[model samples]
Target: MPALPTAALQLAGFLMAHAFWTASDLPPGGHYQPQSLCMRADGNRVLNSFDGTNPKEQDEAARAFVTGGAAQWPDCAIARQVKVGTPTGDVDALVIDVVQYGGSVMTVVQAFRPADKGFRLLGDELMLGDNGPLPPLPAAQAAAAMREGALDHPGMDGKWNQWETERDPVSPLVER
Candidate 1:
């Protein structure tokens, strides 16, 4: 979509503004302790979807999404669509999985759902750590689950972090 570039800019600006990599909530050793940064998307829709089986467009989107200082770091993110098993229907959800090393290996997952023209953040962003009992693609799985219907969406699957409630946490928290 024409707004793909705008989406990229929004994402990059969002990430840069948030500085999730240096999050104070991360446990030491970069271990996998599944955690979530609970937030509600304010209906800030992105006017495009990286909805192809091939990851070329998704990869580029991921690269563009993670920009500024985070961009300086190596590519620690992937873009892909997860076919979600939903009650209403099967929906292909756009997900970006990012692994950042601050004090811990934090895998950040952002899931988006089909809006009018493009997509919007499903509900909230999820983060899982280095050593956890989750599937290898915990981020993807979590993102897909986000689109499974608007019930009790697990922002972090019971591993709620105090950081989520912080006033100055992140964006897309605004509900439509």
Candidate 2:
């Protein structure tokens, strides 16, 4: 078995040891379900930043970590926040209430990230959340969403092919 990264282990610990049970609450065929985009940590500590209201350039959270925050190691944004409620619990566990703007309405997507699984969007394991939790995922799902987006990480074409070889059913969110 692959040695789970410490981050992944911690994340799993957070979910299994700390997180609580919650429902998907989404209406049938709802597009605003929670999303999480978990990438693998290459070396040391994993790094991350959210897209928030802007999709241009990496956000400030990333800058802080990239500028040598805690772990002076290679970092990747493996986890995302999806609020299920007002954040509660100690550092060990938290429930976040997911929020996303749709036609100017901020819809709440109750979601959470699990430690064992990559991401949870509600029904299946997820890789990326649309806005964070309620829906967790495997990384492949997030890749699909990115492909369906207007633009994508240029040098990652080869990466997607590699993922396809490993996982199937890429989400339509990805572009061609």
Candidate 3:
């Protein structure tokens, strides 16, 4: 056997890497969804400069905060906003959805209220798999939606199962 040339070895490695990446169901950068690449949060806390008077500013601020939060999941993440009619007015509620390689999709549903400064975090819930884009709604409507399964997270219905077949599970807890 003879030693391979350095250039040939490097080219072979590069080709293998490229092939593995191209064959996977990941974004080009193997980081996140291109559509979800909005303004990232400064850190864990999202400070929006919006005055809450203008709808456009409020939406921009909300999206920025959501994107920042979703940044924790570098592999793949998405943010969603849902309008819930409240007694005061309509508010933009945000959800951060993240899916890791060979893991279940996780979601963090959050509700925020406008504060004197910017916005105040009201509450958030962690849900397994694309279970919701749930916004703060009336108790009756929320309950009924949950009961009737009307609130099932839309899209990517069986895509996870397909991915499972293509890749190994991240952990033993993942569905077999």
Q: What tens digits encode model 1's per-residue C-alpha lDDT throughout 1-176?
A: 01112222223223322222223233432211111121113433222233434545544554444442233333233334345555555543333444332122344344333333232334455445555423446544543343232122224342223223332333232234
Query: Could you tell me the TM-score of candidate 3?
Result: 0.28
**lDDT for each of the candidates?**
0.34, 0.27, 0.33
1-176: candidate 3 lDDT, tens digit per residue: 12212222222222222222222333332311112321223312121232345545554654554445434532333344445565656653444434332232344443433222233333323233344443334322322322232112234354323332433222212123
| Clash counts for the predictions, in order | 8, 41, 1
Residue 3 C-alpha lDDT in model 3? 23
Question: What are the clashing pairs of model 1?
Answer: 30-104, 30-105, 31-130, 31-131, 32-129, 32-130, 32-131, 42-174
- Models sorted by lDDT, best on top: 1, 3, 2
N/CA/C clash count, model 1 = 8
User: What RMSD, rounded to one decimal, does every model reach?
Assistant: 17.0, 16.3, 21.0
Best by TM-score: 1
Model 1 score (lDDT): 0.34
TM-score ranking, best first: 1, 3, 2
